[model samples]
Target: MTGQLDVIREANLGIIALNRPEAINALNLEMIDGITRALEQWADDEEIRLVLFEGRGPRGFCSGGDVRAVRQAVLDGNAEEADTFFAAEYRMNGIIARYPKPLVALTHGIVMGGGIGIAGHCAFRFTTSEARFAMPEAAIGFTCDVGVNFILSKAPVHRALTFAMTGVPVGAADALALGLTDCAIDPARRDAVRAGIAAAAGAARIDAALGALMQAEMAPVGEAALCAAADRHAGLDWTDEAAIIGTAGLEPQLAQLALRSPTSLIAIAESHHAARRLSHIGAVLAADLRLARLLCRLPDFAEGVRAVLVDKDQKPAWRPNSLAGVDRSSIRAVVGAA
Candidate 1:
């Protein structure tokens, strides 16, 4: 329907394809608007029985939102644009979460940040061996939005916090193990699976169609080592953040925390903790919107985006600079800003 997005109706199935391959299909406000409009139009239509999501790119499904653009808007003193971007993006995430019909996401390659926001909420998520998932917002000086915290809340807290705070990319096996995705299908079979779903859409035979297709194409993924290790150390006192980070086995994760923005880390950790108690996606997204508004205006967001996106220097001068420099009052202010 738009240059950056492809929306089509085929055999009663509504399909959405993210088409910005140059940027790994990173979403802009226009793409978000297009997706939301399509979902809104299809929501009550008797002809549309299912919705399928896919991305057009060899590199990945979606890298994330186009935060570089948001950063530019902020630099131009148009913070309202940044706010509008997040709000519209979050609204689209909410729509995907509450869609009336069964929704399927065929995510492959790099699916991070907002990519997870959409795919992770779908009713049926299929991934390829090439799929890599992460929430790298903390690294970008942004708190995880798009209801990812809500998804991470269901996992073991230690692992969830590590993944959320560190921005570590995980493979499809780990994604399934962490409950980020539902199944792994052969990459070559993706089109067949889509065709099968499309053919079965109108007859209300989705379950049966997927069952047969999955039986034929499902690939076996090995157990995820990260998840296994997390389970092995699940007894560790996760609440004692310092002691856990200082633990010998978690040195790599601790190192990742050291590289990210201190303010973002504090906000991300607090948000992840808060999400555990959130019973629904709507509540978590509301909390996310509140944090996003405050966090984007802070200095770290600008610096982080500059270093990681604009300059590609990978060196960000965080406002607080280090975790020790961040105070409880600062954390409370962000978490309570909403």
Candidate 2:
């Protein structure tokens, strides 16, 4: 094990497990750098034909980047440290997306924020029944980064916007339907599946091996009730910006969005649309970098993180407290919208 990450070279498989179970394997900068280095080294390694990512602890595969530390950096007058962290994290996402070897992520439990960054780009994305997925950056007064918007954009526009704005978590079935995960295996079958993958990696039969697993017809447990409720609750007119604004209290999802930073909501919507048109993961990540640089410096980001993570208080005093109060033009500029 290396620091918070487990870097293992077994047979033809390179496995990296996030080892911070106590904190739900929340990623820190060291972990990001370590993952990047491993992936880079393995990219050219002839022996490592495939890579597998796992997360330690029962709570989830990965909760996300240590944004609490980012908040701390800003409070300590080291905002540049926060910037550096995001830059490196995004870089790692790119590396994983472009990896020459087939990459599989065995995501269980909570996969949020930075967790999605790593898992979402893999060639083979697997989840257990207990896995929950979300890109909850808006709730923390931040916009999506690490190319999450790219993943979200791949889903239906309404679903993407709702998740981005509300921070609602979806289960494995919803994830599969949304194209977030490829297969849902029984939690009890975790080891057998890992062994199967290892064998496939050794034999250079990755596709055939995984296809068998996919054909198991195992029923995906858990459903996205909240996501469904949100869809049923409202038919948002996204074309007209005004229709999406100032209606935060109209439904359950909107109520959650009401509690988030208004600026974050605007940015999420803008970025989601921008990502839809981007030609590739690299382009989406580049957009995310620009948006992250801007969002991290905003007052709402600090306050939102403080209220939600640091203080454990749900009350975040957003700078532009209402959606209508936010400047769409400025947010569009940051997200590269027309």
* Whole-model lDDT values for every prediction: 0.82, 0.83
Q: What would the per-residue lDDT of candidate 2 be over residues 121-206, giving only the tens digit for each residue?
A: 99888888778898888888898788877777777777777777778788887787667788888888888777877877877477
Measured over all alpha carbons after superposition, the RMSD of each candidate to the real structure, in angstroms, is 2.3, 2.1
Candidate 1, residues 1-338: lDDT per residue as tens digits?
A: 77899999886889999999999999999999999999999999988888999999899999999999999899899999999999999999999999888888888899999999989999888888778899888888888789998888888887887677778788877788778998887788778777776776865577777667656767887767566656666665533446556653465434566577777777877788777877899988988887898888889899999998999999888887766676646556645432
Q: TM-score, each model?
A: 0.92, 0.94
Lowest-sum lDDT 10-residue window in model 1: 246-255
lDDT of 1: 0.82
List the lowest-lDDT window of 10 residues for candidate 2.
238-247
